[model samples]
Target: MHDPEHGDGTSLADRPHRRRAVDNQRRSAASADQVHRAMVAVRERTPTGWHAAARQHIDGALHAFEVEPVSGCIDAVACLIPPRCGFCGWRVQVGTYRIGFAVYRDGGARVASFATAGDALGAAIRAVGKEIAGTAHR
Candidate 1:
């Protein structure tokens, strides 16, 4: 069969398909650059003094890389807490229908729970910065 309507002779190589923005190597480099930029921005925007601490804590355990289903994913994080308090670690309640992050300060008595660990950390950074700068009341 000639199959003129099928465009069989129209050349299969010209078939429509999504064109890549950049070549594989360039695309990979661009992606990596974007991730690094995001990480740096997040780190920088985080209050002030806490930037160093947060970077130290998250850089080691966090894999700021791309995933199949989710283009970019920040999977798993580690924080280096002071040895003064022995309560620094992943916290879990025995009988609670809640899940999120729990932050404790001043001998682990004052606890603050957040919907997500990122939020908790962000709040901590901002709180500390504000307290130090004396602009917290505002």
Candidate 2:
């Protein structure tokens, strides 16, 4: 038989080399199978594998929204919006209304009356929290 690693003919003394080469081939095949199995397991466990589950959740939510499209690929919805001043800069596509502002170093005041106690408290909390946290308040 022809040998791959060694091209010359094998003698009786070369039996050990042939055995070692076969053993190495078996080990290499086993290791390759192990690596393939590991990659499959990782793909099953990672976010890339969760597309079906995420789509099920999104579909269920969208079904309740009166009418919505259901034919788009999952990757179509994965998007990033650059941060911007909603008042002056281009609006983000996530929502219809522009609801952001820019602030000067010095404090500025902006307010609107609320119709209910809950709404008033929520607005107050948001405004005060933003001021204390050094951010633009709505």
Displacement of residue 87 (Cα, Å) in model 2 is 64
76 in model 2: Cα distance from truth in Å?
34
Off by over 4 Å in 1: 1-110, 135-138
lDDT of candidate model 1 versus the reference: 0.34
Taking every candidate in turn, the Cα RMSD to the unseen true structure, in Å, is: 17.1, 22.1
Tell me the RMSD of model 2 versus the true structure: 22.1
Q: What are the models' TM-scores?
A: 0.24, 0.26
Clashing pairs in 2: none
Candidate 1 residue-wise lDDT, 11-113, digit = tens: 4443331123223335445434434544544455444323322222132222222101121121212232221123333221111122223345546776544
Q: Relative to the true structure, how large is the alpha-carbon lDDT of every model? A: 0.34, 0.31
| Cα shift from native, residue 42, model 2 (Å) | 1.7
Model 2 lDDT at residue 17: 72
In candidate 2, where is summed lDDT lowest over 10 consecutive residues? Answer: 60-69
